[model samples]
Target: MTSSSKTLGEFFDSFECEAFRLETLDDYSKSGNVDAYHAFLAGQPQPSDYNAGWVEELRSHTRAGKRVHRVHILSRPLTDYLSFELGWGYRKNSTGGEEFFILDITDKPNPLAGVPDFWCFDSASVVVMNYDETGKYVGSALLEPERVVEFTGYRDTALAEAEPFVEWWAKYGT
Candidate 1:
C-alpha cells in the first residue's frame, strides 16, 4: 500500500505482534493532554482518570499476547516536561501492560542520534511522527515499505542498548 493510503491509527489498531516506539524528544508537553501537563506543572496529583483511555487500549492489546513498548532517548538533568512524562505518564501507562525503556546518553554518545520519532508495528510497518519545535503535534506519515528495513534495524539497536524503564527509573527517575 502507498504512504497516503494508511494512517497511524490504523496501524495501531491492527498490529499483531508488537508495536515499538522510539522517542527522540525531551518534551512533548504541547502535544497531548495539555490540561494534565498544566496540572503536573502546578504540582497537583495525577487525576485518577489520567490516560485511562490509552491505558485501556494498551491492555486490550497486551492481554491478547501482543507487546507494546518504547525506548525514550534522553540525557541528564531531565527537563520539566520529561519529569512529568516519565514520573506520571510512563508510570501510569505501564500499569496497563505497556513497557518502557530509557536510553540515557548522558555519558555515552547516542547511537541513534538524529533519528526521528517513529512507531514500528510488528517490525513491518513504520509511521513517523512529526512535531514542531515547540513540541506541538503536527502530523504523521506512513513510511513506504522499503524504509521499514532501516527502521527495524534502528529498533533493534535501541532495544539492545536501552535499559528497562523500571530499572532506569529506580536509579534516575524524578
Candidate 2:
C-alpha cells in the first residue's frame, strides 16, 4: 500500500527494517494503559500481564531481525507518569528486544526544542503524534514524503543526545 493510504498502525506492520519513536511528553496517563498507571500510583505491584500485547508485538518485529526503538526527552525529577512508563513500560518492553533511550535535558539545553513527537518508519515515512495538554492522545498526522528528512534529523539528534535506558534508569530511576 502507498504510504499515504496507510494509517499510523499500518506503518507498524509495513516497516521493513526499523521503526523509531520520539516521546517528548512527560505524562501520558490519559493516553493509554490508564488502569495500570492508576495501579502504579497506588503502590501496587505491576500485573504480570502489563503491556503483554505490546511486548508480544515488539517481539514479533525483533525476532524477525527488525528493529524497534525510541528516545524519550525528559529531565531529572521525573513526573509520576514518567516513573511508571520508564520503570514499568520501558523495562518490560526491553525484554521483547525493543530498545529505549533517555535524552535527559535536566541540565543541558534541549537541542530540538519545540519539536513535536513523531515516528519515522524505515527512515521513509513520518507520522507526527499529537497530544492534548493533559497528555491525552488527540491524533496523528502523516507527513508527506518531503518531510521524512526533517523527522529523521530529529530522530538522529535525539539518539545522539540520549543515553541507553538501562544506564539512565540505574542512575536516576525512581
Candidate 3:
C-alpha cells in the first residue's frame, strides 16, 4: 500500500474500537434533499427520537472523557449537515461536553486532473464526497460561510496531513 494509505490504515486500526454514528440523507430519502428532510424531521412528534440513542452514547463518551468524532459524508455541502446534526446533538445532549470532528469532502479536486470524480457521500475515518453537483466538489467552508477552515482534500488525507488541527481539536475541542 502507498505510504498515505498505510498511515490511514494504521490510524483506523488504532481507533477500530471507536464507535461511530453514521447518518445520511439517503437513510431518510433517496431524493437527497437533506435540508428539506431535516425540516421534515424537525416537525415530527419526537424530532430528536431518530438518533437519540447515538446522541446518548456520544454524551456518555464525553462524560467519560472521550471525545466524539463525527464524520459526515454529503453529496452537497458540509455546512447544512454540520449545522443540522450539531444543532440536534447539542440540543439533545446539552449537558455533555463533547467535541465534534467533522471532515466534509464535497467538492474535492480529483488527484488526477481530467478524471471526473463521483458525486456521492461515503465515510470511513471521515466523511468524503458529501456534496458533488455535476461531479464537482465544494467544501464545507463554502457551504457554511461561518466555518473558516478551507477544504483541502478528502477527509482521510486531510486528517493525515493536518496534525496540528487534530492536536488542537484533541486538546481543546471539548
Candidate 4:
C-alpha cells in the first residue's frame, strides 16, 4: 500500500528495519488499559496476560532482528501512570525484546520541547500521535515524505541524550 493510504498501525506491519517511538506525555491513563491501570493503583498484582498482544507483536519484530524501541521523555517523581507504565508495561514488554530508553529531564531542559509524541518507521514514514489533555487517544496523522527528515533528527537527538532504561531503572525505579 502507498504511504498515502497507509495507517499508523499498517506502518508497524510494513517497516523493514526499525520502529522508533518518542513518548512525551506522563499520563496516558485515558488512552488504554484502564482496567489494568486501575488495578495497579489498587496495589493488585499484575495479570500474567497484561499487555500480551503488544508483547507478541514486539517479539515478532525483534525475533526477526528488527528493532522496536522507544524513548520516553519524562521527569523524576514519575506520575502514577508513568510508574504503572514503566513498572508494568515496559518491564513486561522488554521480555519480548523491545528496547526502552529514558530521557530524564528532571533537572535539564527538554531537548525536543514542543514536539508531539510520534513514531518514525525505518527513518522513512513519520506518524504524529495526537492525544487529548487527559491523554486520551485522539488520532494520528501520517506526515508527508518531506517531514520525515525532521522527525528523523528528533529521533536522533532523543536517542543521543537518553539513557538506557536498565541503567535508569537501576538508579531510579521504585
User: lDDT per prediction?
Assistant: 0.92, 0.92, 0.37, 0.93
Considering summed lDDT, which 10 consecutive residues are worst modelled in model 4?
A: 1-10
**lDDT of candidate 3 at residue 147, scale 0 to 100:** 20
Residue 78 displacement (Å), model 2: 0.6
Q: Pick the candidate with the highest lDDT.
A: 4
What ordering of candidates by lDDT runs from best to worst?
4, 1, 2, 3
Collision count of model 2: 0
lDDT-better candidate, 2 vs 4? 4
Cα deviation of 119, candidate 1, in Å? 0.4
TM-score of each: 0.97, 0.97, 0.34, 0.97
- TM-score pick, better of 1 and 3: 1
Off by over 4 Å in 1: none
lDDT of 1 by residue, 64-97 (tens): 9999999999998999999999999999999999
2 versus 3: better lDDT goes to? 2
Q: In model 1, how many backbone clashes occur? A: 0
lDDT of 2 at 170: 90
| Candidate 3's TM-score | 0.34
Off by over 4 Å in 2: 1-3
Which ranges of candidate 4 are over 4 A from the true structure? 1-3
